[model samples]
Target: MKKFFYILLVFTVLSSCSEYQKVLKSEDIATKFKMGEELYNEGKFAKANRLFAQIVPNYRGKPQAEKLMYLYSNSFYEMGDYYVAGYQFERFASSYPNSEKQEEASFLSAKSYSMLSPAYTKDQKQTVEAIEKLQTFINVFPESKYVADANTLVQELDFKLENKAYSIAKQYNLISDYEASIKSFNNFIFDFPGSSLREKALFYRLDSAYKLAMNSVERKKEARLNQAKEFYESFKKAYVNSEFISQADDMAVELNGALENYSTKS
Candidate 1:
């Protein structure tokens, strides 16, 4: 009985494949459309996409074009071809400005770009682009049900940019390029004032300043030490109980001691 059931299943699968091939090659546009939509509804997006691609141009000016375009664009989205999905959805929105699906299409288009964002450690051009797209969606659809999700994606992408900037600044410090590290951190503080990484930035900036001051030549030592002392004061004022407070305190002691030596020489 099980063997008969298995044979029947195999036969049904082969019959379906044969029919699908026939429909795919049949020059019947209506048949293609009907089969494409059925396949799409069944979550067979890849197969649906092939049929839609063949008939898309033929249905351009027809009343069914809008529905067909939506399905076609979403098929790419479902298949994770985000680049094409983004472009196609954008086109769909532009073409069907009055579509009931306009808001959804716009949101999905922006989301598709967001999906293309690379890791924070990589080049951030796509991340920037995604942020712009998401922001536009939020601004245009302030009352949309998708606004909350769009805002979340924007925040995530924003953090990616911030993290990338913070990492570059920290990398400069790691390479002992204290001047560049200080400059980068200063820029980061100015650019992302509300960043969660602000605390780390402040601590590292102080660390960089301390190292730079302590390593200066005799002629510049006193002035650099004074500047480093000021950085310590700034960091401590902001974070009295910071994780780096102990190291910061040790640096402050060295800075103050160095300054006292300068004062005694006067």
Candidate 2:
């Protein structure tokens, strides 16, 4: 009789639990959403997220689903898992193109990516992605509240990318890879005309060209000395007040002498 009573109690609890779940599901969908909001307000972000997730699939095609998805995205944002949260917010905005929350959703999505962006010298994929996504945000929502901040982020991230490239090009100069060095430095100048390092890049290119021309001799078919003179003259016109002017002039004199001597001997 004791074992029989125990079995009956277990069966009754199981049936009650199943019935409770069904009752919760049967409640007006708006009620479930309210419960979720209440949980979120009470700082039960996890529970609210689960509740919001629960309603979306069952309430699909209903007005509640659209609202629930927006709240669902905010739950993750509130939880501070920005990587996932950003993606979720973007998903909500993309999935519900006609919703009133569209602008808010896009802003939050871009903001979330900006939050996850790492420092410039570290992994920059997130930084790059943030720039691109935020540009899209700006293009889509010209009047968004996040525009000012996103604009700042785009500028900062672009500087970050440019700095990396500029540093690499300068490195070529450090190693005396003169041919490659001049090319890279010229690329930097052309690609980033407004770069703060523009003058420095131009100077390095002149230095590289001078050295390359110094390697020129009577035996080589290539008139590298002439090429070097061209680079020096180009740099001088761009940077007249440059500290390198006097030294560059000296190289030109030396290059002329070397070529003259080589020609006379040949």
Candidate 3:
């Protein structure tokens, strides 16, 4: 009985494949469209995608165009070809503004870009793009059912961008590029004021200033030391109970001592 059932299933699958091949090669657009939708509903996205591709051009300007394009873009998304899906969905959004699927297509287009965003260690161009796209979706469809999900995606992408910027600024400090590190960290703090990394960025900025003062030429030491002291004051004011408070205070003692020494000399 088991063997008989297995054979029957194989026969069924083979018969379906045969008919699908015939559909693929058929000149009739209507047949192709129907088969493509059926394949899509069956989760046979690759096959559905092929069928849709063949008839897409013919359906343009026809009543079926909008839905066909949406299904085509979604087929690529379901198959994990998100780069192509993002472009295709974006095209659908612009081409079919009156479509009932407009909000969904717009959201999916942004979500597809989010899929392309890499780890925080990588270049963040895609991450930035994802944030922008998701924000645009929110702005356009304020009450959309997908608004919450889109907002969540934007938050995640924003954090990734913040992490990348923080890492780059920290790297500058590690490489003894104190001047650049100070500038980078300052800019980072200004750009991402609400970032969880703000405390660390502030501490690092002052630390970098301290290091710069220590390494400065005799003519520049006093000025750099004064700048470091100002940075220490800012850190103390903002992060009074921070994990870095003790270390920052130690740096401050050294900065003030150095400043006093310079004062006595001048």
Q: How many clashing pairs per prediction, in order?
A: 0, 0, 0
Point to the candidate with the largest lDDT.
1
TM-score: the better of candidates 2 and 3: 3
**lDDT by residue for model 3 (1-266), tens:** 99999999999999999999999999999999999999999999999999999999999999889889999999999999999999999999999998999899999999999999999998888898889888989999999999999988988889998999999999999999999999999889989999999999999999999999988999999999999999999999999999999999999888888888877986
RMSD of each: 0.9, 8.4, 1.5
Error of 1 at 61 (Å): 1.2
User: Once superposed on the true structure, which residue ranges of model 2 sit more than 4 Å away at CA?
Assistant: 1-59, 78-80, 115-128, 216-222, 242-266
TM-score against truth, every candidate: 0.98, 0.68, 0.95
The lDDT ranking, best first, is 1, 3, 2
Q: Report the C-alpha displacement of residue 193, candidate 2, in angstroms.
A: 2.3
Shift in Å, residue 69, candidate 3: 1.6
lDDT (CA) per prediction: 0.96, 0.80, 0.94
Model 3, position 186: C-alpha lDDT score = 87
Error of 1 at 160 (Å): 0.5
TM-score of 2: 0.68
